[model samples]
Target: MRRSSSFVLGAVALACAGPDRDAAPASPTSSDATGTSGGSTTVSGSAGTGSATTEAGDTNGATIGDTTGDDGASSSGGAELGVPMFVAQGMVGRTTVSCDDGLTWIGERSWDVEGDAHLCGSTTPVDCSGSGSTCTQRWFDGSCSEEACDCGHSPGFSKGVEHGAGRFVATWGWGWPGAVATSTNGFDWQTTLDGDTFGGLRYGGGRFVVASRTPQTSLDGITWTASQEADFHGDDGVTIWSVRRFGFADVDGGRFVAYASGDTSVDTLISSDGGGSWWRPRSMPSDCLGEGPGAYGDIIAGNGVIVMVDGDGHACRSDDGGSSWTAHTITDSRIASSGVWTGDEFWFWGFGSRYSSADGITWTTTPIDAPDDIGPVARSPEGTLVAVNNVWLGYEQQAFLRSTDGVTWASLPDGDFTPGHPIFFIAFGHAEPSAMCPGT
Candidate 1:
């Protein structure tokens, strides 16, 4: 993991309206732990002063090398299960793949081109496979399937999505400003141009928030506003700077928290009342301040608390929303970039090991069969857990791991991505595809 090079250049004029918290979130320092900020550099933070203790009752129920674990059908939630979708954005093309049970995936060619730009129909499929499959049409020039134009070659990268209430809003961008595609049915989409650069787009508390360089919010997924502005304070509670960028954001307890790394310190941007407004806390955790803690990973919030963990085996808990933080050390350290709050416990992992905690203070470790780099973990609305490993056969191929209890993981079939292109994003959710193209 590395630190981001971008910084707030001019003096920030925004006011600091957040609470006087004890500490902020963690930053990455090692190659294993990457920061949420765009740039990758060595991250450093203060070490925890408290003693590290291991849990007594071992939770190691499954074999560490077993990849044939049972599919957790019993833990599936009441919500209707949709197609499991994954997006692979290479240097040239963006591939959207869907699976029924996550064991197999079928890629959807969102765009294609001939001598002249012509939209491929169900009879003549383009980049995706299938004889009679009508691929979901997406246009780069703000034109969806309604109009026929020759500008369908650039299928933008699908950044993230917010789905609920029979609606699906997916954000995508590559070079230019970000845009959104809203769909009542996940198959066909209506594209809208957005001002903010989309990275970590999230929807919570009835509002949508984008954690881009210039953070923006929207009541609906279309009309966006740059309302999340605040001054960042260092651990000393005096040095202030403008928030230039944000990363790793989550919504819980009616508050939206986004991590921001500074030149010398790290801070979190907080928004209460749904992404309508934002602020930064006064104080920060001494351990999280002044680059040296080793490695910062990701943030997960649930069960009335927000927890941030680093690759150096340190964990910080913020109980009063984003006000203050308490640091704790894990006995066994695992480098993890993504974590999931399973409504009962927190699970974070990297390659071979998995870490879990019920109270966010005392944590236990469970070795897994994962042998590659796990980037992000997504839980379906039906409670099925899916994790994406960046490397399977090599760096080119990607693998999917499924778990029902967040403990035992089963390796699914490998994704047939382009030979040298790596997958940038992965997601699993419920989608109501149109009757024309039922998912495979």
Candidate 2:
């Protein structure tokens, strides 16, 4: 494996290889390991130790690559909270996704889009997939669904949530400045429009790590304040496409893991203290981050072992998150779309089918009832794993699918849930999707 520790224009002097693994970048001299601040080369201090014994967003051994084979999620309160499953529609009085530590999560999205934009609106305050089958009255902008104008997408609603006080926070990243929104319970929300595409999100250690298509961050979960901000639209290092809540692994301290498109190099990034800092990204051992606008990432339990059939073909495992990965590649032309954490395994869906892995690795693929593009994957605090597929064209495709286990797939009916805005997926949740408690 390549390693980097230097100060060249403040960019973390990475010790990695490109498509040519043989061309590993030289490791910086000892003094350089103690990186300096400022510029892209900056990665040091108590805050930037960049230790291999490091962790991003959560999901691995605090001692990088130290997989002892025991996933400590049972104690992380995951089991105690009943294997978080997505609640298609959070029962009004109760919070949607709750925590093992007694905290409740609420994502009450309040967006205002024009009529022409009706692929679907925030159907409910929380779960947004509506009867995309029926052509909406008109578009949000031009009555021609094609020109739908909007203020932002939706996350769903909120109710009486019980998060571990301070442990409960929210982060949203719309497409523009002051466009992001957050809420402790799906009821109250804070907004930001820093011009970042808020893909996936998670709340931890009193802050939020909002992942964008680029490398942007925020200090508070409700704001776009960052210790360091990068041009989210810039062409540079790692480019994270999505963010998710990896609360499955149950790491105690503040940390999070964001599955994103690494710069020209790595395919994923892990952040321990929200998005304040990042580790040198690593590429997927098998597939490249994909050519489609598709996002790639799979959650791991306490042991840092992931059962991912996400985006890439075949099942894979990353004992060290993406820092060091090992995957089983397949020639099948398919995408391992979205997934969830089952009490005993991980499940994902895509290309009209479903797949699962017991230890976050190895898999059993099969056909399912959902259409393509199942991006929003959530395993509620109640253990209902829900995955949604976005069919911008209507009944020609099914919008969302549900899974009781990471393997089985089903449909989420929009019976009573108020299809508030129309955010089919504001998905958060992963085994350490945010960060795993210390040891696994």
Q: What is the alpha-carbon lDDT for the whole of candidate 1?
A: 0.45
Residue-level lDDT for 7 in candidate 1: 17
Query: Compared with the true structure, what per-residue lDDT tens digits does model 1 show for residues 86-128?
Result: 3333211234444454555454334332211223232232322
lDDT of 2 at 299: 47
TM-score, each model? Answer: 0.62, 0.52
lDDT (Cα, 0-100) at 435 in candidate 1 = 61
Assess candidate 2 and give its TM-score to the true structure. 0.52
What tens-digit string does per-residue lDDT give for candidate 2 at 197-253?
Answer: 444444434344455434344444444554344222112433433332232222333
TM-score (C-alpha) between model 1 and the true structure: 0.62
State the displacement of the C-alpha of residue 408, model 1, in Å, after optimal TM-score superposition. 3.8
Candidate 2 overall Cα lDDT vs. reference? Answer: 0.35
Clashes of each: 21, 92
